[model samples]
Target: MKEIKRDLEKFAAEKFDLIIVGGGIYGIMLLLEAVRRGLKPLLLEKEDFCGKTSHNHLRTVHGGLRYLQSLDLFRFRDSIKERRWFLKYFPEFTGVLPCLMPLYNKGIYRKSVFRIGLPVNDILSFDRNFSVSREKHLPGGKVLSKEKTIELFPSVDTNELKGGMVWYDGCLTEFQGFYIAALKLAVQMGAKALNYVEAVGLIRQNDEVSGVKGKDRESGKEFAFNAPVVINACGPWSRDTAGIFEKDYPRLFKKRKLLWNVLFDREALSSHALGLRSKAGFVYFFHPWKGRLLVGSPEKLVEKSEAETVAPFQKMEEFIRDINEIVSGLGLEYKDILRVYPGVLPAEPDGSFSGRPAFIDHHKNGGVKGLYSISGVKFTTARLESDRVLGRIFRHKKAISYDEMLSKKEICCHSMAYDWQPNGEDDLEILKKIIKEESVVHLSDLILRRTSLGDNPPRALAILAKIRSLFDWDNKKWDEEVDLLRKQLREGFPNQKPRGAGNR
Candidate 1:
């Protein structure tokens, strides 16, 4: 990993083949694809890499099994292909997660539906286990007896507990690390990826985009980079970014789905991810990760402005109440939550889950030359989506065999020496390396995104002084960063109150 500040001068001087805005997983994928094809690509992120929507996923490398509901085989295969890559190539950050969806009635959510669906799904994903390691290999789905379901999930509603269906899926063990690893690989493969760099506007030659003008958050200095093509891979912010140039940009963003996932401190399940329908009939995933209960997906649409931030306390309270009602044994409340993973995703014009990524060539659709925008559907298929976008961007170029480089396994930042220690005292050497290379402009970058300390509030608070000492931040700077992090945690965490007590 290299610091963006150190290479700022070179970055400004170079005329690159492609300029990608947004340092989320989608941007990272584009960077990787660009470099593999021997194209000079520059990646810019307004915040820390993977700090926003990309970091707050359910941690599942979806295998397209969910797409069966819509009978979308194209998306289903795409997910299976990407999931296979993660399970086979990045075993360190990906794992086989067994999921159980309990059947309660003789409707769509019944055992008979799964009994036929699982085998068909298995056939569709027949090549899923190809070249995958034994330990990471995913097994096909099977029906569980009612008694077995009761044994597995003691809190399951018994009114119509007609057994359950068990299926296998892949989980992203450490998303922050996994994303960083991908970016680092792209950097190593001759792509320039810079964090904390915001692309304020597009540099256009007449109607065609030439490059971008960006501001470095660390120094507050603005710089420019020239490129023939620019891609808007900003995920939820795709339309907003493109709006800088093209007005009436086909309204790429139809609706913003505010997806929220809550993590509880206490153990909610012994093992296996439990999929249950909420009282409102929406499917909720109750999965165990890092000793916490992860539940989500009773999605609600919100205004684009409010979609980027955390959900309101009232909404969170409502979610908690719904969960409590569905699984009375857990009896969870807002106080039990450790953190709330909140993010916004692009939806169909009618505000439905399209379940497929959208790629737009601004030149073709919006009449803006040399500009393109991509809105991804899910994290699992980001790589495949990037490949498709690249195919359109470099239309006639034959792809190089960079499989070996792309597939190389990497250790996530958290898995480095000193492990989960948030305080810098535990491992000074690794801490210094991270601070220097990973572009630590703020304390939150280190604690919240780069390390696991941010996941645990008390631990992050305990290590503040140590971090201050390690980074050599002045009192004023240290205080500012700490205050900002506290504010962010308050909004991001479930237990903490929103910014203004009177407002909430």
Candidate 2:
């Protein structure tokens, strides 16, 4: 928190080569890249970093095997490369996840098809596990007999259950830590970032974007940040952020698609992630992460404006019903859901590209200059997209090698903190360190994103009073914080109702 205040002062005074609005994964990664290449950069987030779409991801670094179905070898290669890069660089935060797809006597999901497809997948991602640690190595896909499938997923439907195909993909054990670690690295590399700051409008000169008009959410003090180039990487709020520029590019903004996932504590799905097709024919992932089963299928498109978006409670029930009806013997009920993660990603009305384009709309192409907006989709490819965006902006500049960037004296990149358990029960010391270093402005930021406590509501709420005391908040301040967190939890995870609601 103190560091954020100091950086805010510094940001107000300096002129940056690049100013990025939105501190989601894309914006964070872009800031890291810009600083690595010796460019002055500033990043502002309206809320806490990775508090939205980036934090609600399925936690998988997909290897693009899905693209093989469309015969898109280029995309397959790109996905595999990004997957391998993350596994190699952030070994502490990621690992290889075993994914299973049950085979039936049907189209695409059959042993015969996998027998051919698995080898093709292996050929396409031949170097997927190259130079990776032995424990993190992703072996080639293989077919499992029906008996073996039943042993792994005990509740498999016996009717025409031929077998299953197993493949390996990367999974993030601690997504929030990875994102914050990236931002910290950027800071060490001379990048400035401040959360709870919003770009309310654009500072323009002669119809060209020259800077940004920002308002500190806490202080309500407005300031202008002068920059030659400004990038808008707002995730779900892309449309609203673009509106600040006062430009009407009708197709420039699209309604965001809301993807929802329900977590079950029973571990009914076990360790492996299962790919199951719903009755509606949409593919849903059933994976066990951190002792919970996560399930979700087709993404629901939001009918309301982004600001008014909220996941209806009915959707959570629907998710449970859909999974139970399709997969036999797994009688999951609404009460079984421990939490719900519903997040949005921008998309065209026709559902084209699915918000994966990184729409680097250099407004010069549409009348306004020095302004760009990005629509990020997948979490797995954020780094790849950042490289592309910076490549275009700094095309002629001499590029710095990854090795050189790491060798810099100031860059102190470390493995994710939550990747391994602490040697002792030093909760107070750990909490104090997080509050001091991680820009924890709100109680939810401290619990939800900074620590693992937020995942378990009982434990989090039990320690709320202690956290309040540690922060030295008055009763009124503490109540306000708890109220804000309650509102957020209700909308974000309805199952984990307010403290006294007894919904659980």
Candidate 3:
């Protein structure tokens, strides 16, 4: 990975075939594809890679079973293929998750209708041995008696209980970990990827894109890199950045909006993801990971101005209440939530899903012949989306075959291998060591992002302090980081009061 960084720095000093703006999953995936094609690609991120919506994911590599309702067969097929690909290539992170769909005596879809849909889903799996009997990891579709339903989901309301259907889907244990792994792979393949570099402008000559101008956010120094092709894979921010180039070519731009939400710790209701019909829309996937449960609302169009807006606090609270009311076994409250995040989904103005099918537009009239844009793909389909975008950018040539790239394997970039494991008895000692080494401040960052402590927050502070004691930092550094974290907590979480204030 370090070698790839050095090579990228060298390429940036000269010229490159591709300069990709945005370091999220889309940008990183493109960088990987380009470098594998022997194209020296430079990737820039305004913040840490996967720091935005990529980090905030439902963690399910869905097979698009829900899309069957909309009859969006193309997306459904692409998702299933990609799910299989990820499971095949990265089995360590991806796995088949058994899901239960508990039915009520009074509900929308009947058993017969679901039975028909189940066959469609099975067909979409390409006859690849996903049957319940063949795949024991997944529960087969069966109607359970009321007594059996209680055994299956003990917490479900018995009064409304009917039998339920069990099925299978794929899940990623950690979305951030997956992206970070991909980033490491891209670096290994000779892609230059640097985080915290903000792209400020598009360098053009006579209305053609020549390269990009950016500033190192950490150092506040500006730098430039030249490339014939520049890709805008900035997710929600793609349109805003593309508009800068579109200013020179007024005829080539449009925008659209999309919204998603997350609800945590509500997964105790079912062993696998669940789908339910709600008055608002279809509620799919009550996904459980580690200890938290996540639920998402359907994707609906919103105004561009409200694109980045999050679900209101009250609305999120209501969502939690409603979900709890629907799912018998799961019980949660607003206080159970750790955080709420919102991101935009970009699209075009023609009332079509601009990026859903992986929209790619080339701007040759303005001098930048290789400038391309990719938008509208969910996490499950990132690999295929990247392949599609790169195919368009590379003019439909096989940039680098997947088999060859996987065959030349040089490194194993697994986080679990490097992460600290505590001897059951020495957990305190290990925790202290981690805190000391990382100089952790806020309990949330320590537990949530850094370690698994946030999942069980009651012991987070003590664990944090223990971890901190292991580091040999001077009192001054400790105090500084603590102060910085306090300020961050105050600003980032205005509602939550500081815990154990006297500890400071």
Candidate 4:
């Protein structure tokens, strides 16, 4: 990775085939596609990778099951295709999550309507030739009796409830981790990907994009990169980045908006993800993660500038409060909350969401002949989205397909089946011996980032003494890291009050 960074530094001093702005899922996916085609692309991010809406997503790899009302057959089909591809290629990061649509008397779609719709969805998926398993992948949906619905979700509002429907979908364990892995893969494939670098403006020549000029946010140093093709894949900021190029030259760009929110709670709702409808709109998927429940996604229109705006703390609290009221009306509470966040979905001026039909436009008349803009799409469908965009950009006779690297067996291998491995006695003994020799501080470093133990502080420190002896670190470094961790914990949780204050 360090070597890749150094190479990027050298490349930035010269011109390149393509330079991609934005390090979100879309940008990273495009970078990977370019690298796979031997393009050696350069990728830039203004913040950490997946630092925006990607990280803030509800984590459901949905198939647009609700789009039937709008009759967006194209998007619905695209989502189905993308969902299958993600499950096939990234099984280690994805899973077939059971999803329940709790039917209510006041809902938009009735039981018979859903029964008919499920078969239609299956037929569309089949006609598209997508490899979604009818038996295992979706199970074609089933009708649950009112008693069964209450049995499944004991806290559901029975007055409003009218049985339910069960189906299958996918969910990600760690949204940021998956994208970061993709970014790392891009770096590994000889692509230049730098985080924390801001692209201040476009480098134009004779009214076309030549490259970009920006400074390193960490070092406060200026730099320039030259490229024949510059792609704007900045998600919600796509328009803003395009404006930088359009200022000196006339260019075309459109802006659209969508919003999502994540609420944390832990009620005894079914383990399956739930998609429900309310008076406002469809509320999709309340699922458990890291000991908390996440529900979301209220769609609304907003100015492009407000793309990365955080939801008001009170607004988020109110959202959870409303859910709690519904749950409590059936019986749950507000004590379940842990956190809240907001996300944006960029759309086109025609009131169409980005990524469904896929947008790939190039500015041939601009000073830079190959300036392009690729926008809109969900994370699950990232690979397909990239394939379409790159196909337009390269105009190649043929390009590699995701299937060449991914297979059903490989996908299953990567899934949760391999996540929890039990080490034998010999391995455990070796680990203990290594820990005894290395010492606690070095062990802390190893376990914190390298292993998943850092998510829980108590478990993280429990093995510290064992790890301390392995590295043979004296007390000094151990104490230093411990103090640093303590400070980090305190700073990371500014709003959390100290325990026992209320009782006092």
Task: Provide the clash count, candidate 1.
Answer: 0
Q: How many backbone clashes does candidate 3 have?
A: 15
Which candidate order results from sorting by TM-score in descending order? 1, 2, 3, 4
For candidate 2, lDDT tens digit of each residue in 371-456? 88877778888888888888887787665766576544332223333223333447576777778888889888877777656555
Alpha-carbon error at 247 in model 1, in Å? 2.3
The candidates, ranked best first by lDDT, are: 1, 2, 4, 3
Candidate closest to the true structure, highest lDDT: 1
Candidate 1 regions with alpha-carbon error over 4 angstroms: 1-6, 305-308, 406-413, 416-419, 422-426, 492-504
What TM-score would each prediction reach against the true structure?
0.93, 0.91, 0.80, 0.76
Count backbone overlaps in model 4: 22
lDDT of each residue in 1-504, candidate 1, tens digit only: 444344777889999999999988899999988877888899999988888888788888888887888898888898999999888867777888999888985568888888899999999999999988999989999988899998988888888789998999999876666776777777776788888889888898988888899998889999998998999888888887888756535456677888778767677584889888877787789878765688886577888666356676677778888888888777886566766778888777788876667778888875669988888878898988898899888987776654567555344445632225643445766666777777777778877776666566655676666656676767787778888777666655544743221121
Global Cα lDDT for candidate 3 = 0.60
Q: What is the alpha-carbon lDDT for the whole of candidate 1? A: 0.78
TM-score of 4: 0.76
Could you tell which candidate, 3 or 4, scores higher by TM-score?
A: 3
- Using TM-score, give the best candidate's number: 1
